[model samples]
Target: MKVAIIHDWLVSYGGAEKVLEEQLALFPQADIYTLLHKLGSQSPLIESKQIRTSGLQRLPIGDHRKLIALMPYAAEQFDLTSYDLVLSNTFAIVHGVISTPDQLHMAYVNRTMRYAWDTYHQDLAAFGVGGGIKRLAASLGYHYLRLWDLAAFQRPDLVLANSPFSAQRLQKYYHREAQILFAPVDTEQFAPAETRDDYYVTVGRLVPLKGIDLMVKAFTTSGRRLIVIGDGPQLDELRAMAGPNIEFTGKLSSPQVAEILSRARGYLAMAEEDFGIANVEALASGTPVIAWGQGGVRHTVQHGKNGWLFAKRSSESLNAAVEQFERLDWLSPQLIAQSAQQFSGAAYRASLRQQINSALQRREQEN
Candidate 1:
């Protein structure tokens, strides 16, 4: 089949990009289409693809964030008429692409653009740019984006979700039901170590939604050590708020991240993630997680079994959970790693093939 993969942007490597990478692995012949492509910004495997970017790429501005307003237009402008199948890996606007009646368009939606819906104001405030005329412009832009986002859902033949949590969001926000497909976890790449380090670890973009501040606060009050890996907008702010026991490693190589996860006392996850891949990585390392009790972690983590889930999203709740975590028995690393193996790349490839076959069969029947 002549397949084309649509992604929102290729400016950075992230969870959605990771999913896109897996999709590329499944359909090596598929051409990649994105709103913007910053060369050398992602994995060499993705960089090796026949990547095609939209007009957004030509913008003189280095920041992709400023181009959000033009994304819907850019997304719709991608020409996919020649392709037999169009697979979209959407976190933002890529799902809005115009598809022909003859093509089967399948979407793997990680998030339904929470900024345009659930966390609209919070995002504005977090970015510290939503004031006066800027706020008014953002509000109007997101409003239009919302309208376009709703219409975009109608183009896809089938929609798949990265997690059950994402499926729920797809239903709630887009008014569309999506089949659940867990994101691929490189279980083989993250193996358990015989011994663990004394400190807790958390790996991800240091952003407001990640609740890094909450983790830092909780760990600070408890006087337990925390090692935070990764960098983002809130890095400096989080670093300022963190106490002596907390350490920031900025960003590290994949092997370094794996080694830290393998040796850490437990992985601390504070985000209401679509699917906490880092949690799976931790489990693969035979480490448990202390996660906020919401989103995809509810499915990945078995409370009091594989990991502990705080009842609330606050630091107090997380602190209490930490206190309780100190009293729990150490889980078997082999068993924890075994559980995470179910989300391995092999499983994703099989499930993706099944979904594709089913989608193709459905299209044939319709014709």
Candidate 2:
């Protein structure tokens, strides 16, 4: 069957891109379509695919978010008329792609676009649109974007969510129910170490929204060893704020990240996650997570069993969790690693196939 994979963009390798990569593994010959793509920013496997980008790819813009106005137009321009199956792997605009009645357009929606929805106020503040014309224009832009996003969100024949939290978001925003399919985790690649090191580990884009700054401040003040992995725009700022106890290892390969996760005493996460795949990976490495007690991390972390949770998005909260964390006995490495199998790549493929077949069968019966 002719297959097409639609993605939001390829500016960088992120959770959404990671899902797209897994999809590519399932359908190696599937043609890829995206709003924009920057070469060498993704894995070698994805870089080898036939990636078709929109007209916006020529803009030479560093941030993909800058093309927000042109996004829906670009998304609708994708010519997928010939494909039998169209899979939209998105956290952003790719769900806006047009589809035919005969074709199956399935979307793996992570969340509705933040700027158009949940983060609208935060985005307005970040852009410094205090009042008058700028705020009015920004508000109208997001308002229009919301209309387009909701219409785009409803285009897919079958909607699948990465986590229950994501499904809840879909219900809240689009008033649509979605089947929950946990994102694939590479459990096999990240195995438990024979022994753990004394340092704590945290991995993710070094962005402010990721709460890397919170982790940095907590460790800096306490003088506890922290190994910070991953790189992004906030790298320099984080580096500047980091104390002698903090170590930044900008962007490492999966194996290197796995090795670090496997040996670390615990993993630190401050961001509000959709599914918290990195935390799952830490569990696969037998490393307990000390994260903000919100979002999907609440689903994975069983307090006193695997790790501890903090109440707020502050350094004080993380330190409080850490204090309690030190008071408890160490969690079992073997059991923690074993618990992560539910999110393995193999299981993910099986569930995805089942959902596709069931959705197609239901569609046929309705016809």
Candidate 3:
């Protein structure tokens, strides 16, 4: 098969990039297309691919920062007609890539554009873009993008949702059904350790969307040691707000993160993620999670079994859950690790291969 993979942008090696890496492994011959790329910013596995960037790559705004307006148009310009199958690992505009009627276009969506939908107000508030000419401009831009986004949703032959949290939104917003395929965790790479540590750990982008502020406030009140192991635009602000009890590790290698997870008392998930990959990674390391009881966490975390889930999205709610968690007996490390196996790389590969083959067969029958 002549396969092609389209990604929103290759800025950093985050969750979406991890999924792209797996897709590359599955289709080694596939040429990759993206809106922009920051060389050496992602894994070597991704950097080595035959990646082609769009016209937006030349923009002065590095990595497409503050330039969402042109993404849909830029993405639609990719000429993917030569390929038989196009697999898009998109969190942004790459889903709108133009495909010939003969080509199969499938998108693995993390979630619909949050800046244009559910988290619109929250994003604006977080970025201090509320009520002004700036807000008016942002509103108009998002309004245009929302229209484009909705139309783009129909272009893909199949939409694969990373979690039910994402699938529900796709159904609600686009009136489209997506095949559920949870993003994989490399279980083999993260081994369980019997020994544990007193300090809790949380790993993800240190951003407003991640609710790092909530975690800092909760841990400050509880006086619990929290080791945050990631860095982003919100790094400086988050560091300033964090108490002495919180230790910011900036960023770490995968091995370092796995080692930290293996030794952590538990992983704290403050964000309402579409798919909480870190929660599963924590389970893989035999570390239980203390997550906000919403979004993807509800699907992964089994309250009082694998880990504790706080009811509300506030610091007070998280603090109460921490107190309750301290009262519980020690959990079985083996069971927690076993729970993560279902979302392993092997499982994702099998499911993805089956789905792609089925889709191909259906196309053949139709032709």
Candidate 4:
């Protein structure tokens, strides 16, 4: 089979990139088509592939807002006629890649664009784009993008959702059904440490959507130690808002993050993730995850079992959960790590392979 893989962009190595790496392993000979690529920014497996970039790659990198307007047009430009099967791994527009009726095009989508939909108002507020002319212009712009996003979401022959949370949104916004294919974590890299640490850790981009501010407020209120890992636009702001108890690591190597996670007293997650891969990685490292009980983390973090879940998205609720988590002494780190085995890379690949096999067999029979 002449396979091709379409990915949104290769700026950072996160859950989507991990899934793309697995897709590369699954289809070693497949050519890669992406909107942009920060060459050598990915795992060796991805770097070794034949990468083809869109015209937008010429612009400044990192999924910038200026680029979003052009993405749908750029994505539609990928010539996929020769390929028998095309797999698009995206959190963005590559799912719109054009394909022939004779071809099989499937997309492993991790999220529905929040800026254009559910979190539109919140995102506008975060960016300081608001009321009067600014809001109207921004809303008008995203309104058109949302229209295109809806149409692009339906272009794929099959849609694979990264988590049940995302699957529901795909169904609700786009009126499309998606098979849930949980994103994976590299359990081998995130093994438990010999000893636990006193400080709690939170890992993810520093963004309003990530609820880092909420974590900062809670930890600051209690004067508890919090190690914030990863960086983004909110880094400086979060640092300014944080008390002495909160420490920002900016960004770290994967091994470094794993080392930190393995020894942490627990992982703090406030965002309602589509799948929460970092939470699973923390769990794999034998660290309990204290998260807001919403989205996909609810599926992983059981209240008072592996970790505690705050009922609300507020700092007060998170603070209460943290206090409650400290009193619980029975949750075993080893058991928590074992439960995360289901999200390991090997298991993800196996399940995805089976799903693809069934699709291919059916296609062959139809032909």
Leading candidate by lDDT: 2
The root-mean-square deviation over C-alpha atoms between each candidate and the true structure, in angstroms, is 1.4, 1.2, 1.2, 1.6
Model 1 whole-model lDDT (C-alpha atoms)? 0.88
Per residue, candidate 4 scores C-alpha lDDT tens digits across 40-86 of 88888898888999989887555556677888999999999999999
On the 0 to 100 scale, the lDDT of residue 59 in model 1 is 81
> On a 0 to 1 TM-score scale, where does candidate 2 land against the true structure?
0.97
TM-score of each: 0.96, 0.97, 0.97, 0.96
lDDT of 1 at 365: 88
lDDT tens digits by residue: candidate 1, 1-367: 8999998888877777777878888899999999888899898899988899999888899999888888888888888999998999988888889998888899988777888898888888878864799888888888998998999997898999989999888888888989999988878889888887799999999878899999988888888999999999888888888899999998888899999988888889889888988889899889999998888999889898889987789889988887898898966888888889888878888998999999889878878
lDDT of each: 0.88, 0.88, 0.88, 0.87
What C-alpha lDDT, on a 0 to 100 scale, does residue 111 get in candidate 1? 76
The local lDDT score (0 to 100) that residue 41 gets in candidate 3 is 90
Writing each residue's lDDT as its tens digit, candidate 2 over 1-367 gives 7999998888888777777777887888999998888999899999998889999988878888878899999899999999999999988888889999999999998666876788788867866789998888888888898999888888999899988888998999988889999988868888999988999999899876789999999999999999999998899999899999999999999999999999999999998788988999999999999989888888888877888888889998898888889888976899888888998988888898889888889888989
Clashing pairs in model 2, backbone N/Cα/C closer than 3 A: none
1 or 4, which is superior by TM-score? 1
With a 3 Å backbone cut-off (N, CA, C), the pairs that clash in candidate 3 are none
